[model samples]
Target: MARGAASERDGSLSDGVRPGEEPADAAPPALAIEGLSKRFGDGAASVLAVDDVGLTVERGSIVGLLGPNGAGKTTLIKCTLGIVLPDSGSVRVFGADVTDGRRAAYANVDAMLEGARNDYWRLTVRENLRYFATIAGVDPDSVRGRHDRLLDRLELTAKADTPVRELSRGMKQKVSLASVLAGGAELVFLDEPTLGLDVESSRTLRRELRRLAREEGLTIVLSSHDMDVVEDVCDRVVMMANGRIVADDTVAALRSGAGDVVRVVSADVDDAVVATLRERFDVRGVETDLGAVERDGDRRDGGDRRGPTAVEVAAGGDALYDLMDALRAAGVTVEGIETVRPELEDVFVDLTGVEPGEGGSDEGGSGEGDLSDAAADSRGRSP
Candidate 1:
């Protein structure tokens, strides 16, 4: 996880959970930031991206801004939505001060960040959610039943009169998430909302972004390379790399410190059973090819290399039960053992040694033009 090994630890933001609701221990911070930083092209091609980061984000939580590929998570989500501009920080939204002159702290704050080009390609998913809910000034007769409940909770109310370039790219990412929740936004900011979608439209836009944070309390801030959609729709995962924030908690406390895994599978997993399972546990990645034991048991080079091989390690649950009695006392015939459980893509490839959309190519360059210049800096400001 090079890129300056995440400047040795500095992540903090905790009071998270709010899925089926229950979070009100002094509720405040629906996005506070602090000491944030950014840099980009100057001397020796500048490039610091974002560092000294801090975060808060409570109020109906969903937060998961993981990293990799210039780990600044789109420049800390374009510096917490003021659309990049943080040489030092203190953003604050629910406590106001969005760099003062604050349009009412972003008037509820909405964002879609260009996936499916944040719609309007010849409008009509109910006219691009009533013209971005009138450029997010809202009051479309007071959200018109919250814009038909955000197009029937992103099922897109039968494609709401279709045409944002004839839908599909997961129906223009649910009409760019119903044009950012048709301005009923209580903090949204969803950059790669299920990137290219399809796995039942990325599980129906992550179950309508967990029903917009469990029964409409809102506040979601998800960036994604889809670590299974940030381990099934994030309940707190922060991560980042190089430009700081090395790991914020909960995704079951970073998959409980990523310790237990132990898959096996063997047409006699060789190399002396991987040097006796790396002299007893903590190995990590290996795969061999009895034609990938049904396509994902691993192994890749020209497959069908006569039968089995796959060994993953990392133990510690009584050293994985004494590494299954030391791989059956070193005889190794186990054609498959289990107990893996530790994902968020193995804690984002062990805290960002590059793997989610790995250093580039999950669409086009400059991370989709830096999320279309932060969704054109929230067009005319504040949404």
Candidate 2:
């Protein structure tokens, strides 16, 4: 939410308004949540899906919502969208509280959950856009220009007249996204937006999302298991675990906080050598390239099949020196050594104690069936 001094001069703020002063017509943050809590059941069977969470997403920013399965991400989003009412706390969209009037608060909000929306299969891609726009209380004809642009940007213009049911899954996904934006929603929630996209299509979508946020001042809350997309497109990341926010910061800050590890590749490293190194250092993992020694002409005589082994040790600061000294004592000649910075996935694992794709099935107490039902209900109604 911090704005630079240059923002004032660059017309980022209302004219003549000083820094931190809100103009009468100034828009509030795209979304706001305070002390939000949701529980599925009572007594011993109860599960806290969202645990007194508070978050604010600035206009024109992309915030990545990340967590492993059953992390309450889905439940939290459902609560925010009024698909699942919270036990306590409040959700406000565009300065209107949902409790006051969901229709007014979410008038300009739209979401694509689980990688796709429920687009009309019988309608053409263009018709689907117009239909969604109409249901959202916008005149389809009035936003034809925007619809055209969305189709062009998503590379669906050629198939705009094609029936959505006849399109490939990837194309249908694109149409779903197009439908979400056809109404010119100011705030959009996209879950796994790039799920069915190819590499090129995914890149296109990423570029379009950045452009929309930068040029049109669109705000987005993106949830995806694809760390690269989140890191590439999001301004900030909010990570959840056990129905609570564990880390909320920029991707760079998270990675930097996780520190760095040392990768040591040596031709002399065998199981015994790795075991010795493990005793002295934090060995994250080891990969043995069976053909590396033959390829690099480091193969030994006497029918030794051992090849170059690369071991990643979580050795930061002075620990790195100890790792090197131990390797030398083991009579290991280092072939390659470099410090490897932790990625978002690495930091996620460090904080959550599990890989992004592995976790329990429940989001708080609600199962996948509950989430799907909520999503389906949301899609059936116009925000």
Best by lDDT: 2
Q: Highest TM-score, which number?
A: 2
Supply the TM-score for candidate 2.
0.87
Off by over 4 Å in 1: 1-27, 31-130, 135-162, 169-171, 181-186, 189-227, 231-253, 256-258, 263-314, 317-325, 328-341, 345-383
RMSD (CA, Å), each prediction: 19.0, 5.8
Residue 349: error of model 1 in Å?
19
Task: Quote each prediction's TM-score.
Answer: 0.33, 0.87
Error of 1 at 287 (Å): 11
Poorly placed runs, candidate 2 (over 4 Å): 1-27, 115-117, 293-304, 363-366, 379-383
After best superposition, candidate 1 residue 163: deviation in angstroms?
4.0
Poorest 10 consecutive residues by lDDT, candidate 2: 1-10
User: How high is the lDDT of residue 52 in model 1?
Assistant: 82
